[model samples]
Target: MSGADQHIHIEWRGGTCRVKWWSGEYLDNGRKRYESKGGFTDEEVAFNHGRDKLYEIRHGTHVKNRDGATPMSDWLDDWLAAMDHGHLTERGYRSTVENHIRPYFKKQNASVADIDVLAYRAFKKHINAKMKKASSAANIMMVLGMVLDDAVPRLIKTSPVERTRRRGKFVKKPKERKKDMTPQAVEQLACNARTVFGQAGYVFIWTMAMTGMRPAELFGLTREYCYPNWPLSDPRPDDEETERYEEDVERYGRGDNLMPAIRVERQVQYADSTLQFFPPKYESCRSLVVPDFLAELLKDLLASHDHKWVFPALKGGSLGAVNFDYKYWRDVADGADERSGPRTRGARPAIPPVPSFKGRRLYLLRHGHKAWLDEDGHSKFATESRMGHEVPGVEGVYSSVTVPMERAIMKTLQERWDRLRGGSSGSDA
Candidate 1:
């Protein structure tokens, strides 16, 4: 071997060895090699030691024939695409790729292999930066582990991610965000929405704060589903007008719906052209819910309009964050939607500021609901149910739904939201 980069030549001389240095990682025999930290005692020892080192450095560890070698970038792409027909949820597959996985790895080469602790640390720093949040960065690690694990029998001899996932000194979730949204702050937002967005928009914001439902739930809500005149189990609506429409809803969605029994159940996401409902996070399936007032408000939001879908969704109520699609509504934090209104002579209460706009993710609303429910003395289990947390058990088995106080809970919630929205004192409401 000659020249000067990081290369070594190993000559077998019985027990003694000869080694020569050159550039690059390949050996004289067309195989890959590595360098040793210390020189060998004999010429033969030097050749054998250097050869082993070269293999270790290139393929990582003392392994032979590093087959299926590809860059991390290529592997991730294959992993994400592979999720298409797999059991993973659309939200899990798509978003795990987008928000956490892809952003950090989009540029990595597909042919590279053998990552060490040092490389991982540096890579983490770079990825942590691109990630929008610390939890998001953590999620990236998780998704990467899953993707690599799926490749266990395929490309990888063993997952580099297994070590990466358990690496030293984990970064804690940032405490600065203060994921709490107070009642007063909620009211302020509502006031701002009413002043800027008028009735429709303000109501939309209020519904999210009160319900704990994702934005899509509000948007995809249809008039027919919540206000159906059928019995709770009966799918059909009433034949006659019945005693009253509002009373029937109040008894169900507003009444029994708040029973403190909840589950994440299912999720709706847009795919191809239409909306599809699937198991929620962890493939959880069931009805996630909150106090009855939310049930009532949701029901009311549906009842007041003739639209079939909950929010202003097109193409049969596409799922996920609907606001993310509408640039006009999206400009709420930026006040970009500011235009001369008939009532006011100025732009609408436009985007407040960059910091303010950044504060309004779907999780923010969920956090706010958490503070509200906790203040109201709701149990942690109930709250978890509202969030669609899955109960642990043996998988590849039957699944069930369970919620104890589903109706009476609604009674309390309805009372609370009326006061919150109507500007009345709701100590118990």
Candidate 2:
């Protein structure tokens, strides 16, 4: 018999026949390959199953079956460790794998080949049972899909979790547009944050609301890159802090007509309880122009503190995400923790709501900034550039943000500030 025919065998286990076979294909590293599949009532079906494994080897769509027998829990762990992830993203991925993916698959012993559309459907069902929000389930699925897609042809033939409508219905919920915080709500959140987190909190929230900066980008801002005065040069250290800032000076310089701007180049993240910094997401390094009102406020902040970070924690360290959320943001957004003490009365003054803000994230302020730009009627190109998103198609080629464009944006923002804050202009800061 040929080598492939010699390797095929049949065995009865648990009142059913199992097909055992050699794939006749060595791994790239020259390791032997084998496969096992059961649940056939007759030897003929078992033989056909063994032949199917040989057929797959003739086609290059699959590799040796070493990883095929490995449990999904172990495979997912290996997959997560093998892929490149930034500190923050790695944290999130690990959480999903540990908290959600592993538990659901704990009883599953089926290898990569055994995992199929039915398995994914069951996983989705588990997710739906556990999660109340469709968005949360969707997020978990996204990460799972990424893992499976990367495992193609090596650990599995193809990703079992397909996005297509298999049975005349879409599997996932239709994408929903996130609601934006209103102008009034944005103003209130900033003011309340100031009261709760002090001046640093005010500057942090206001800057994000006006600038549309990612939270990491906000945490990443430094004194050197903060340009409070429009079209005017700020004092630069003798040594360049970042090469990107130096390149910006060489390429764009301080044009006489340019508006006040902040340099957004890096982002702060946490890994293993330690702080890490890297280029902003997608390397979306850009200068964000500040309105005149915000410029003055930033200048005041810059003058008040000569630290390395523009928005450091009250203590002498970079802000932590957990610390920022629970200590400051949650209290302000959801109202001061319901004041519980032995001497306290039954009820306290009702905490006023900030429209769509209760139980929502501080990032909503950033999303609201985009809505503001859209309402102001800025060109899509300018809006996308300012938001650090790449504008698509030919419009991106022909469209460049001009002096007039900058002025219009600044004027619109200034008008909003004046109208909302009742012409107070925030006390020269």
- Each prediction's whole-model lDDT (CA): 0.51, 0.75
| TM-score of candidate 2 against the unseen true structure | 0.74
Q: Judged by lDDT against the true structure, how good is candidate 1?
A: 0.51
Cα lDDT for residue 311, model 2? 79
Q: Model 2 off-target regions past 4 Å?
A: 1-51, 62-65, 85-87, 106-110, 162-187, 229-258, 334-359, 420-429
- Pairing residues by index, what is the TM-score of model 1? 0.55
Residues 1-429 of candidate 2: C-alpha lDDT, one tens digit per residue = 666677789999889988888766577888866678889999988897787778777776655656666778778878887968766677788899889988777667656667789998888898988999988999899888887887787788878987954777567857545565555766677677766645777778789989999988888777767865322353443365567446556433555655678877789887667777787887787788788888878878878776677877766366654467877678667766445467854434334456467777878777889999999999888899999998778998888887678778889988888887774433211
lDDT of 2: 0.75
